[model samples]
Target: MPHFYFHTENGDCIRDDQGEDLPDVEAAREEAVTVLGEILRYRGAAFWETASFSVIVTDADGRTVVSVTARASDAAPEGWTLQETGE
Candidate 1:
């Protein structure tokens, strides 16, 4: 097993001092996505201010293993109405 650190950056860098032990890089990648989703789920309102967010995963040796990013854009014209998509 290997330890991976999940650092995040929205506007400022947040270092992950406590890392997680997983099987391999693949697992770390999945964890990164989960972490990213959790962040958005909990702090989604304030997230729009940054316009972009990322989860940077690094191994114990300080090597980058995976990186996950999300970007939001709201470029609607004035008085734009939401159309119902017949989903």
Candidate 2:
């Protein structure tokens, strides 16, 4: 099994364990996106304008395995901003 660290641009962090049969990096990337989407929805910002959102997937050795950047849709509203921050 492999442990993956999901770091969000909004400074949220989560850890997930992928089974030994986990797929390739592309599959991991997709999972990361879906996880982030769930987070956004939970925070009531699913339809908000979001840009520069990113996911960093690290292996057990703490090395980056893959990174994914999320972009807003073409119809994103003007003057929208992501409220992610670090404390």
Candidate 3:
């Protein structure tokens, strides 16, 4: 068992002082996705675009094993316009 830490970066750092014991890097990557998914559920769709952040997974010795970065891709069809509602 190896200890893994998840560190979040979005103009600032959120360190995971208490790490989890994951079997390998693959498991750590999966855990990071699940963690980010839960965050997106609360923050909503635009959070990924606005924040442009990464979920960094590190080993016990602080060696980065994987990084998950997200950014919005505006793939709207041509001539599509966003409907604005009165505030």
Candidate 4:
């Protein structure tokens, strides 16, 4: 197994000081997608404030293995809003 680090960039650079041990790069990629989804689900509104969001995964040697990014393609439509009922 190899250790992997997942660093994120939205408005600020967040580094994963403590990495995880994974089987391979493919597993890390899947983890990145799941991590991004959780961030979006909990912080969707704040996330959109930034131009883009990204997850840069690096291996134990600090070499980038995989990357995932999401960007806002267009401006939000008029009257567009997100409401949460604490669900």
Per-prediction tally of clashes: 0, 0, 0, 0
Q: Quantify all predictions' global Cα lDDT against the true fold.
A: 0.93, 0.62, 0.82, 0.89
Name the candidate, 1 or 3, with the larger TM-score value: 1
Could you list the CA RMSD of all candidates, in the order they appear?
Answer: 4.4, 11.1, 7.7, 7.4
Candidate 2 residue-pair clash tally: 0
lDDT of 3 by residue, 1-87 (tens): 999999987657789999899988899999999887766677655565575666899999999999887655557757889999999
What global local distance difference test value does model 3 have?
Answer: 0.82
> Mind sharing the TM-score for model 2?
0.50
Question: lDDT of candidate 2 vs native?
Answer: 0.62
* Ranked candidates, highest TM-score first: 1, 4, 3, 2
lDDT of 2 by residue, 29-57 (tens): 77777866676667545434444466677
> Per-residue CA lDDT of candidate 4, range 1-87, in tens?
899999999989899999999999899999999888887888788776996788999998999999898777587768989887885
Colliding pairs, model 2? none
Q: Which candidate wins on TM-score? A: 1
Error of 2 at 56 (Å): 1.3
Q: Pick the candidate with the highest lDDT.
A: 1
lDDT of 1 at 66: 91
Error of 3 at 54 (Å): 1.4
**TM-score attained by model 1:** 0.84
